[model samples]
Target: MRSIITISREFGSGGREIGKKLADDLGIPFYDKELLEMASKESGICQELFVKNDESYTNSFLFSLVMGNYPVSADGRINPDMPLNHKIFLAQFETIKNIAKKGPCVIVGRCADYVLKNEPNIIDFFISGNTAEKKKRILERYDIEKNKAEDFIRKTDKRRASYYNYYTDMKWGEAKNYDLCINSSKTGVDGAIKLMKAYIEIKEANADK
Candidate 1:
């Protein structure tokens, strides 16, 4: 199997579950919010700051300038002029690379796939779902109402897309940017997992030739 699996997913698409299940099934480590803690520790940034900027773009003009004015890294390598968002991204990017180097892992979100795009053993996947299904799932899991869930999904997806597009050369949720794009609403979580397992197995087996 591939040494690294990165899953990019819509907010309510059950992508984290898939990644966790895949990692469990394959006996590899799974990472999601755990990455935030790593970046926090490794970068000397507070855990709360990482959580605040996690997968989010800096939108305030003045705020951006202020954060940019004091840019620095944990080890003092990054340029001081860099923005806070960029610093956090660099921290996560570095952390992702380090994790992948340790061996196979299933990482959900945080643009791990894009961060490791040059690596040969990495496989990337994007998971989306039907609007209704996404809304339903969101409503059930969160305190959001039916109407709010729709708006929440749209806003969250947009933020994720913007964050991704800002960091990577490719567009978010685009099929060409990933090895596979699956509609979990149709395939369901287990079915999607099955498909990914088969696909990864085939790809890895061929690599052995």
Candidate 2:
């Protein structure tokens, strides 16, 4: 089952849960927060920096890129003066590529679909759902107050969209950007999973043939 699956999702769309279940069922690794952990360890950059920049744009890109490589490269070893945000992004880019090299796995968010865009064995998906359904899911799942659910979903989705657009050439959540776009509100999680499983199985079978 040589495939790398990346899920791009709306804030409350159940995309992460779907990715986790897919990895488990496929007996593969699921990466979401794990990517940050690896990046921090390998790059010597603080984990908080990566978390702070995750799925969001940084104003310091050009200036930081001008700085060299790492903002705090005191050892005369690092890039000497890289933008903090760019350093974080570079670390993640390398980590994403390294992870893909390890084998077939499921990756969630972090613009992973864009990171692995060149791989032929990749399957990309974008998960979205109706506003009502998403708000309910966020409220229940995060225990967010009922009154705050609407704003929560809107703001989060906006951030994700901005992040993706800033880092990649494509528009976020656009149907043309993904191989499959599932509205989890109608199909539900299990049904959507079933659809993807069938899709991949067919692809694998065709490849074998």
Candidate 3:
């Protein structure tokens, strides 16, 4: 139960729900949009700005270079002199690191898998589902027509992929990048959670030995 989990999920796949349930089952904190709020609070940026710039591939390369890394205290606390946007990025990045330090939380999206790549006790998961199942879920959850659901699914997944691929060196949703890739449509959300729990147990046990 003491393992950081990063979940990268396809749109309409119920990835967020599974992450929440898994964290509850393990008695650990679950973070999603909470990450953005924390970042906003620390950096004095609006939540909308954080969301918009998050893992955004469109961020100007020159801007990122010019901004560079924000100053941090000797103890790694953020320095106050950095620009607002850099401060926001640093805050969210620090949140990811701090969450891992606190142990055993399920973090959703925001390229979390990449952010905490150096951590030893991490299990990254990519959740996806069949096209028909995903489309149905999107339609029902979003209250959209079938055609809109299909288009939404495609566009959303593309955005996620771009964000992930741009931020991380690895390909998004590739089997090798994640410790486990689950198709929730096969066994439903609860079943996927059970499978993940079992898998984590095995990995933990082997690591302990």
Local accuracy of candidate 1 as per-residue lDDT tens digits, 82-192: 766667766776788799999999999977887778789999999999999889889889997676888999999999998777755679999999989999999999999
RMSD of each: 4.4, 3.8, 3.4
lDDT per residue as tens, model 3, 142-173: 87877788889888999888867765567999
TM-score preference between candidates 1 and 3, better one: 1
Q: 160 in model 3: Cα distance from truth in Å?
A: 0.6
Residue 24 in model 1: shift from native, Å? 0.6
Evaluated at residue 114, the lDDT of candidate 3 is 77
Backbone clashes, each candidate: 0, 7, 0
Sliding window of 10 residues with minimal summed lDDT for model 3? 59-68
Candidate 2 least-lDDT 10 residues: 62-71
- Which residues of candidate 1, in runs, are more than 4 Å off? 59-76, 80-83
Q: What is the TM-score of each candidate against the true structure?
A: 0.88, 0.89, 0.87
Looking at model 2, how many pairs of residues clash?
A: 7
- Which residue pairs does candidate 1 place in steric collision? none
Q: Choose the strongest candidate by lDDT.
A: 2
- List the pairs of residues colliding in candidate 3: none
lDDT of 2 by residue, 139-207 (tens): 878877899999999999999888788767789999998889999999999999999899888888888
